[model samples]
Target: MSSNIRIIRICQQCGNEFEARKTTSKTCSDNCAKKAYKARQRSTNVQTSAEQTLQIKLKPIEDIKAQEFLTVNESAMLIRISRRSLYRLNERGELPFVKLNRRTVIRRSDIDRLFDRPAELMEKSRPEPVALADCYTMKEIREKYDISEKALYELIHRHEIPKQYSSIYAYVPKYRIDQLLSNPSNLS
Candidate 1:
């Protein structure tokens, strides 16, 4: 029995028919290939134009609703912090909020106001730094504190310390460490 299977070809542009050496071939000639390419480009242009029109029509509705009251999670997302951190801020009288029944609500205007304030405002609002001679390395902190990296991470994760995201890991502020060291009661 013969092993070769028959192949079919269809012109992509003018719909002319011909035989092909392989099943994957779609055009009868280079002219048909160029024509098919042009047709594809035209379809892409039409799609992009339609999408732009739709976006233009919808943008005003989105803009008008942008300042609506936000949920705690939404406020957290907007501020790039966790919900727990936001709650902490609220508890500390740092973040303005409204208590709606059992739920906490924040206004978009308030969030914008919070962010619009200068960096000095936040610095002034934060707890005063404790005097410490040396900055502790992660290894030193782990060993001296008798805590694992995971435990240290837990403090940062819970927002007990001011932390910044480094390229590979989170770095705790030195003052936070000092505060923890100063408070013997916090050891557990």
Candidate 2:
């Protein structure tokens, strides 16, 4: 019978030098091998997590099919308007829509009709332009200046900007807005 020869090796997990009975022994003990296996599994999980994150970041937009209806949020995103505005328009019955199993959806054709009006039809429906002396509402001013409601109110209270009562709502004079734009120092 041939004599068994032992091999000297270093443990891959614990970094300890030991005599291995088998040539394929990677760790000094079973405990070290289990720990090494767990570490490898943890590293694999981390790599998969990073890969999933990258996939989400590079995800493509879904294609819109013909004759497909869209949800309120989807319609809002497509039309570049806020969800609240879309909801308001739907509630006012200005936009054609349908309810399906408690979900409200607008037809793609209806949205297309809103923007795809004929030039003659649009000209016929357009209202007359307002005079320059007409004051603008606080909402209009906020949108025009891109300022917060609080800031606009503060400016109005400080007398830096002037406003007039229009029966129901207070309106800021257009001349004051023009003055502010002409002299930017008045904003502070």
Tens-digit per-residue lDDT, 1-188, candidate 2: 22466688999998999889788999999999999999999999999999987874454325443437987766776777998778645533347568799898899888877778888987775434444357778888777777677666656555534344556666666766656645656444
- What C-alpha lDDT, on a 0 to 100 scale, does residue 57 get in candidate 1? 48
Candidate 2 residue runs with Cα over 4 Å from true position: 62-188
RMSD of each: 11.0, 13.5
**Candidate 1: tens digits of C-alpha lDDT, residues 47-125:** 9999987875455534534857877866776666898888766644456677799777888887777678799987876
Can you give the TM-score per candidate against the true fold?
A: 0.33, 0.35
TM-score of 1: 0.33
Instruction: Please report the candidate that would top TM-score against the real structure.
Output: 2
Worst 10 residues of 1 by lDDT: 162-171
At residue 2, give the lDDT of candidate 1. Answer: 40
Residue-level error in angstroms, candidate 1, position 68 = 2.6
